[model samples]
Target: MAEQHAAGAEGIHPTNDPGTPGGSVDPQSGADSAAPTRRARRGGSRKSQKATGGWGAVREIAIVVVLALLIAFVAKTFLIRGYYIPSGSMEQTLELDDRIFVNVLGARTGHIDRGDIVVFDDTQGWLPEAPAARTNPVRQGLEFVGLLPDSSQQALVKRVIGVGGDHVTCCDASGKVSVNGKALDEPYLYPGAAPSDFPFDVTVPEGKFFVLGDHRNASADSRYHIETGTQFVSEQDVVGTAFVTAWPLDRFRFLHNPEDVFADVPAPARP
Candidate 1:
């Protein structure tokens, strides 16, 4: 009997073992016996990595754009600025639709002198309330970013004729404007245009300037503003001196102030 029992145990099939491959199982069980497939896990990992890389590229591009915009903003606000000439007020020297660059830094450090072509705000109600120009969203964005000139601001450009307590008179016998009792040799005046169509003598007040345009006939400058009780522009209202013509590459040139024009004019008489 002992021999028979030992023989029976040794004869048992290996398939009956639960730990062996192809072992018998309970088919009604709900749980899955196999772990996840390697191929599925690898595919999921690749998708996750690709998604992360795409976002990283987008983040880097955004940072670069922001930095560029900041630099442009600071430059426009403090270092330099651009202006568009909408009218022929500064014609021959700066024509209609001409673009110019102003030296804001020079204005901050140096002084506004006679014969300087300057850009000034329309403070003291010098300009009438004109309708704003229509601009699309893209143009507006470009202007704000300093890539385009801001034409919406009511600014004027003219040469400084006299400054601060100087006596200025128009048509001093020789058809030339005189400053501080001395006549100016204005070669930049428009061809065949008289020094003044009307005669006037006035002393520029302290902290103000008398400005005139090269296109004398077309410009409604200080000569016209006298009746408005604001004949001169405040020194503080000056945005900057225009130093260069930037647009229309064929017309590019430095806007040099003819210092010798004012060389002989005597200083303003002492108070």
Candidate 2:
């Protein structure tokens, strides 16, 4: 009886033991069953992250674009503006269609001076009436941001020959223009173009400027308009001084004021 009981006990195995051949179940075996489910969940999570990342990238792109346009708008509004040369009045120095940057801040702050090339409004009716312009929305928007040139024809560009109370006279004895009794050797005059085809003597009124084009013969600037009483451009009408030629890559250069031309000219005598 003892032998029979011992053999029966040895054959029996705990139901939860994994090492026994006849065990009912093992806790470690459940891990293998759950692995596929965990793997599937991990794959699903990776896909969700990838989808979210795509939208995040688009949001980043949108932010960059908005920031760029805002910067352009701000810079264009208060700092500088762009304009294209529409005529040959300023030729050689600025060709037709040459894009330029104007210093709006300087003009607004009354930083104007003699020998500076400037753009001014046609408030005195210097330009003939222009037909209404047909504008493209895209082009207009670009112009607003200063990415495209300003196409308005109501402005003119010329060098400031006389400012405020200066006495400006043309064709002194040696065929040169004089300012405040000092002879002007204008090397920037268009080849073979006389300083003035006709004589002119005028004292620029206070808060005004006497302007002239480099192409003297072809331009009807302050010189030609003197008799009409529209010769002087009001300081309030000036848009800005052109600081640089910005487009047509090869022509890019700083448009500096003619320092030497006005250097020795004496200031207007006090009244």
Q: Rate the local accuracy (lDDT) of all candidates.
A: 0.83, 0.85
What is the C-alpha lDDT profile of model 2 across 1-271, one tens digit per residue?
3433543687744455455333345376633333444467689999999999999999999999888888888777678878888898887788899999889889889999988999998889898888877789988987777676566648899999999999999889988889999999887888888898889999999999999999888888998888899999999899899999999999999998888988999989879
Q: What lDDT score is found at residue 210 in candidate 2?
A: 98
lDDT of 1: 0.83
Global fold similarity of model 1 (TM-score): 0.78
lDDT of 1 by residue, 11-99 (tens): 53334335633223335663222223334557788999999999999999999999998888778767788888888878889999888
Q: Name the lDDT value of residue 235 in candidate 2.
A: 93
Where does model 1 exceed 4 Å of error? 1-48, 132-152
